[model samples]
Target: MTAYEAPALVISECQQGLLDPPPGAFSGLAAQAAGRGLIERTAELARAFRSRSLPVVHCTIVHRADQKGMLPNSYLGKMAIEERMMVEGTRDVQIPAELGPEPTDLVSSRATGLTAFYGTDLDAMLRLQRVRTLVVAGISTNVALPGLALEAVNRGYDVVLAEDCTAGTTAEDHRYMVDNLLAMLTRITPAADVIGRLPG
Candidate 1:
């Protein structure tokens, strides 16, 4: 068997929102990350992680054919009717090229709207490769990253979110969520520190 790899990243759809405006689809803080180089930076980080021969996993949200409303447990379930729910195998659910994912990297979940790990067999993949710690990056730091961190920690994995690699709908929203929500669950370390801790 292969050795355990370093922590991996998971990104949410900043280009395609759960719901989007007609002009750009996703126009919130996640959209802002694109304008300010979030995608590029994420890809750059992916490359660095890859160079070390560490495992790099990608996560995206998609829905089943039923395409129904939330199941009452999801944080997203309480949202309004205009929100865009994941419909499996749609264009909005595709992984961005910057954080390229092959057929194996995509994980699916009918219950959890947060990650590709839960409901999917990603935990098995991580365990098989012996990965016990995670370095997470993505859009909507408030929602996606923190939610994912909760899931990972619950499953006995050490998680550190790359603070600079994530963004929210607003600068303050991002800051507040990280300070209040994520801080409660995990450490909010900078991307540079994450790299420093990795193999050189």
Candidate 2:
């Protein structure tokens, strides 16, 4: 399949809580991404992809009040408990306003764990849409992005990392994850490159 055939723009954990964290709760990488305008750039890419009739999937994290689906004894669970993040019906878990996932956008919200693919229908939904290539964007490249990319590659889907559209806990960490790890698994390009390649 061609690079652009049935591509899905998969955004991971671009949630309000993480992107715009409460005072003193923000991570350096997230701040860096915001400072570098990753969120705005990603929003533009999402809109461009949507305008081209491409699939736009937003993978978010939202836990129940009881946190039944949340994995315990883990960093994610610890953070959830400490920060009180991603509670069901809470505004913290909502997608950022700028990205603005429309009614037509596919949303995959999971409370289980970090990876968007695990215990989620994201893979199946992409297949249903006949997606051969995935233009991946969003936050925490150190965790979710790599997990998603690995799973996508294992599932035989071509993966492309939207470099300017994602971030980690630190700029160096993000760069290392993307350049040293994810880059080997998937083609890493700027959001503009990915957007420009879309079929008109």
Candidate 3:
């Protein structure tokens, strides 16, 4: 895919809680991310964006300590509240050190909802920066990244999914979403190609 002007790289839900979960907590996803080298690839993309003076936004999922405003309507939502997963200020919610905000990058954290744009200032930040395209990479291709892509599209931003830099609960699940679902919403791309196409 050709590089689009004013593109921002949005890395969603790449927090420790999701990608490097505790024992017995989302082990499948953790394994998948590690096996696919998701962190390394995402880091590469982040660096590429930074080098080009492009925006790098980290979309993190986090909840308050009291769980206020965090709905328990869905199973995952309920689990997050009950298990205290992704609590703000906790290590679980922090992005991995391998990939960072780096003092220059922006971070948009959401207390509720699945997609980044829903409850955060992500769109406003993008608009302020005049970002026209969004390059997404991160965990759970089964859910969050796909949701982010759809939302970005609806918001009139072009989207490109860095397939190699994302991971789902399993390889099969990841492939299915990328092939059947995500492909319909955005251009599916590899990290290397995206990096190469970026302005130096």
Candidate 4:
């Protein structure tokens, strides 16, 4: 079988809040990385995946204003209280404009912490679609990308980390995670390679 036949792309936390950080938000090295055009690269990959009729799954973080779905005292709650981000029904929680999801795309959202599979049914959804390979990308490579990669492996899915499509708080942080921890679990490849392998 072709490498991409049973593949599904999972984009985690590529929301407006991260792509376009609000004033005084966590716009550190990660923001600088995104500013360097990671978002555009990711969007292009998403478009390519859709063109091949592959499943494009967007995993986001959405929480209520009253913290109804939040894990109390968790990092998510602290970020929500501090950065004031990802509140449900707000622009912060929406995926950015660049990688706009089509009506046929699958959107998985959680109200709590990192790892899209935790409070979401992303694994089951992908399995239901007969997806055995996962192409993962998105914000904070130090956080969500690695977390989701491990989870996908535990659930018996082969994962490919989109090296160019992910960003972290710093260049070192991004490189270290992919080269160290994540590299041990999945193949760290450029998005271009993955896209090129898809059938026309």
TM-score leader: 3
All candidates' TM-scores?
0.78, 0.94, 0.97, 0.92
- Residue-level lDDT of model 2, residues 1-200, one tens digit each, is 23476788999898878887777665675587788788789889989988988899999988888878665578777878767787879887888878878977999988778789988889889999999999999877888899999999999999998888888888788888988899889999888789777876
Regions of candidate 4 where Cα sits further than 4 Å from its true position: 72-76
Model 4, clash count?
0
> Between which residue pairs do clashes occur in model 2?
none
The sequence of per-residue lDDT tens digits that candidate 3 reaches over residues 58-144 is 999889898888888888888898899999899999889999879999999999987788879999999999999899998789889
* 166: Cα error in model 4, Å: 0.5
Better of 1 and 2 by TM-score: 2
* Highest lDDT scorer: 3
Candidate 2: segments with Cα more than 4 A from true spot: 1-3
Worst 10 residues of 1 by lDDT: 13-22
Model 1, range 149-199, lDDT digits (tens) per residue? Answer: 888889998787787888877788888988988887776777767776776
Counted clashes in each candidate structure? 5, 0, 0, 0
Task: Rank candidates by TM-score, best first.
Answer: 3, 2, 4, 1
lDDT of 1 at 173: 84
